[model samples]
Target: MPVHQVNKTIGEINERIRKGKAVVVNAEEMARIVNKEGKVKAAREVDVVTTGTFSPMCSSGLLFNIGQQPPVMKVSRMWMNNVPCHAGLAAVDCYLGATEPSEDDPLNKVHPGRFRYGGSHVIEDLLRGRAVHLRAQAYGSDCYPRRELDKDVTLADLPNAWLFNPRNCYQNYNAAVNLTSRTIYTYMGPLKPNSRNVNYATAGQLSPLFNDPYLQTIGLGTKIFMGGGIGYVLGSGTQHVAKPPRNERGIPTSPAGTLMLKGDLKQMKPRYVRAVSIVGYGCSLSMGVGIPIPVLNEEMAWFTGVSDADIQMPIKDYGYDYPNGLPRVLGHVTMEELKSGEIELNGKSTPTVPVTSYSMSLEIADELKKWIEDGKFLLTEKQEDIVSL
Candidate 1:
């Protein structure tokens, strides 16, 4: 590790926040300050920088502890709103994956599956205080004789509901394009044939992991804003690439670090935790995640000061390379270029659309900033730092 010009601890930052003396800003503002006054000065002046990202995260899921019924049946199979949930845990405990399509969904019956309803919808409905039909089955046992269970339950009726996502908030991702002659529907949204359009999902510099590229201050027990509520970083999320290809600025130019997050579902709002259905890809959860980066040193300030123009994403071909698992890089494009609605590809200006909502990310960052400013939120020292290679 290199020597830092400025040093401030999480404890010091929290104390300043409690005293209403902490200087906080969003990632965009931090970038501007660093550009104007330099990173050393920005580190000394800014206590924290808030970052956010809102995108369709398919790896999200819910853990539920449905109330026990009369006779105390041990659930072996469970379904909530026609979507199957893993009930291999304790009697009434179940895990509902966001992308688990409903049993009644006509998946690819007509060539492309229209997964209208799924686990993500069920979760959103529950959070909105709507009733969900629950059904379960179990083989009779001596201690627990009940074999069947059926009921309609709301979030309030559940003993515990946790939004425990395996992965969320990817640091950076690829900009997808279809090189084939036919249109294709994928998780990145439908791609027009012959590279007619580009679809990318990420909040660029406003992304949490991007602001803390090396995961210097983000780790186990790090407090965060998740789905419009308080949450924590359980650890480095699934598919976390410790060392990915980077540009000159040390920012990853491809899919990289991810976060495993958990929060109380009861505290989350419907708006921040939405259900999404891709045209033919299937169901997913569009969630909002915001993380506060403590400007503990000049290095931290420099990382958080990255702007969209400074960040780049690899161009990928969804029609072939991605599906074939080939590591072929079509090219690279900057977030500024992607957000400009177009990018040059093979001498043609291709239309670009962001699957992730940058505006929503900005709102989350601002909301987190308000929480810190009002002393409703504070920073936490990580019990263990996320591994970096």
Candidate 2:
């Protein structure tokens, strides 16, 4: 790979961004430009490359101020649409988790509440303009004498309601295959016993963190398209693991860099951000995130050229005993191989299905570019070198 001297600085990039003259392209188009125009030419032509993702991030929830009632109370216990929410924050604030099921749900008594609706569903309903029944109880403090109350609430009914997800994106995920005799259930979606089907998550080459495996460009305060609203990267996600096995392109072959996303839930569009209940799996929030990377040099242009063929990953046997020992690796496969719709496994061809939506990601990338072009969004200044290796 040929490296060219970079004349562009962070200041220069921001200046172009501010003036709405920055040359920007989505990951897909950038890859094409790099392949045909070559790195040096592409690097100089492109200032920013946008990347995106839409995945099931269970580590998400809603923060709501259920409005000021006559008898104000620091809500200790609460339920919305029959689904319980965590009211442990403050008098006016509450946190409703995506995976949290109703305590009184009968499904909890039997097994994981696969069909039981949770906080995530409530969030979607609110976004859809559906009213949710809100009930709360308090010890009745002198300042807040309310004991119990019931009312219906929507996103409009609350003064402040937004999604504050500590972690929302996983960099690299496992290709799930079941080798067990019985059907196994997992967060990767259900795996058919005996390698009957293969399910993979994440848009490999199009993923934001996958393109910036080293986290060199993406860092805290980076502006992004979160769900339907503009969101910013707060910091490293909860289970962030920077260093992972890499391919020739330096893309991780295992679970690697993750992102913590935050944005205004009220501004979010339900189409781009919604909650889902995967049958027999769990409740999760499906959200879209788009991050733009500044190609300040030729090296970055080369990095942007990474294709599905260059993105390597392992097929983790979801059937294997986890934690006690590493998940057994069934085999190694590239993003191209997986995207081909099939990968040869154990001398037999196995079909691959995607759990996450790639089209959603592509849409986010284009939307983000428009946001920049219209001057509605600006690239945020890096506050810290938090993404560095």
Candidate 3:
């Protein structure tokens, strides 16, 4: 393995990667390295660490400008795969949120849509090269007298299709367990009644923000794998709750260090980005994201060396009122305990299942490592610091 200067630079790392001398490890491998060799030793030896995650990020959405809707008047309403899209941007531009349901679907009333299909599904179908029904209603205008447009389109048909996520890749997420007498469904996945099971969201130790606690290296303009294509960190994500309480190791306990990201939808693949509708919840985007962390120094190495056993998350009651006050925190437990298949909560053992797949995370990390090794991917400088933003 080739060693970089005390202050490692992206250029040096890229050069080493091209030479096949750069040492890289995924989250799982990093643990073994740190365990046997120690953080300082691993820091001095490894060139980079790969991190990945896939989860139901509701703040994500797809933006598109379908220019083929020729002579289009101001579009008042738009529907993609029966899901209504926000057409307030311009005549050809619209935004479709992952959690947005079709206008015809009720919000939890007389009839349940069961969320058979939604915006996320539409986006996925388009990415899969499948045609989607596009219907638009417009107000007649002088230059464009057309009042309605009907067509079938894929992501390739759009002049510009983009994935613009306002928030994603949460640094740390809450562990949800239901205490009520009935099964409760939340974003963390379905929680059984009487604390039968618990569900967690983050990829645990494999999560990018968790490895880069305090937002040291990750920032705006950083290159990352988003929805199977190359994307850049846009900025600080929305509802990025501030200065969340940290654990003894400085890792956050609450959801934190969220990020905004953007990428060309045309370059994405269906495998990395999928549309999923939660049983009771509406539409949502499930995506796999990969980020490479350069081993800048021993401090950085230590941060990345932190494992699932070290980082902990608070158990929150999904049934509690979220807007008024903080959810009830049953306790702070480590991911190792949560991933052990069951956790002892309040004297009763509760089964814990992961909504995110660790095996999939490994696959993403391996793919990203290959990109780096082939010299196709390089670390990027931050356009702006996320912490200050």
Off by over 4 Å in 3: 1-5, 104-113, 321-324
* Candidate 3 residue 340 C-alpha distance from true site, Å: 0.6
- The whole-model lDDT of each prediction reads 0.93, 0.82, 0.82
lDDT of 3 by residue, 81-161 (tens): 778899999878999988877756555344464575778888888888899999988888797688888889878789999
Candidate 2: how many backbone clashes? 0
For residue 200, model 3's alpha carbon misses the true position, in angstroms, by 1.0
lDDT of prediction 3: 0.82
Q: What's each prediction's TM-score? A: 0.98, 0.94, 0.94
lDDT per residue as tens, model 1, 122-143:
9999999999999999997998
Ranking of candidates on lDDT, top first: 1, 3, 2
Positional deviation of 5 in candidate 1, in angstroms? Answer: 2.5
| Ranking of all predicted structures according to TM-score, beginning with the best and ending with the worst | 1, 2, 3
Pairs clashing in candidate 2?
Answer: none
- Clashes (backbone N, CA, C under 3 Å), per candidate, total 0, 0, 2
Candidate 1: the clashing residue pairs are: none
RMSD of each: 1.1, 2.1, 3.0
Highest TM-score against the true fold, candidate: 1
